[model samples]
Target: MKNEELRIKKSGFWLLASGFWLLASGFWLLASGFYILASGFWLLASGFWLLPPTFILHYPLLIIHC
Candidate 1:
């Protein structure tokens, strides 16, 4: 009887730990996804102005080497 009770308690502890772990991981993933989505929208909104400096001219790389 005592061994059975100990086994139940151990199992309960692991179940609770796993539940919290899953919730935390889910929340972290959700928040990270939201951030990336927002960043993508912001870049898209400013893409015309942002594009030349970021990719077109490569001016920064040239300046760095010079």
Candidate 2:
């Protein structure tokens, strides 16, 4: 249970962090008009670093509000 909780937290953190990165990259791409490089960063920030361990580790990713 403890390990599961930890994994969940880590996944959530990564999800949020990557989401922010994705948003920032998108904004930068628009502001600077840099499509190619910014698109690469956007793709990576969207899922490349956020999806693998979150799903492959068998931890169900969920959002709960308190």
Q: lDDT tens string, model 2, 1-66?
A: 999999999999999999999999889878776667798789977875677775645543343321
| Highest lDDT against the true fold, candidate | 1
* Cα misplacement distance, residue 24 of candidate 1 (Å): 0.5
Q: Model 1, stretches more than 4 Å misplaced? A: 48-66
Residue pairs whose backbone atoms clash in candidate 1: none
Best by TM-score: 1
The weakest ten consecutive residues by lDDT in model 2 span: 57-66
For model 2, the local distance difference test gives 0.80
User: What is the clash tally of candidate 2?
Assistant: 0
lDDT of each: 0.89, 0.80
Model 2 CA lDDT for position 15: 100
The C-alpha stretches of model 2 lying farther than 4 A from their native spots are: 34-66
RMSD of 1: 5.6
Query: Whole-model lDDT, candidate 1?
Result: 0.89
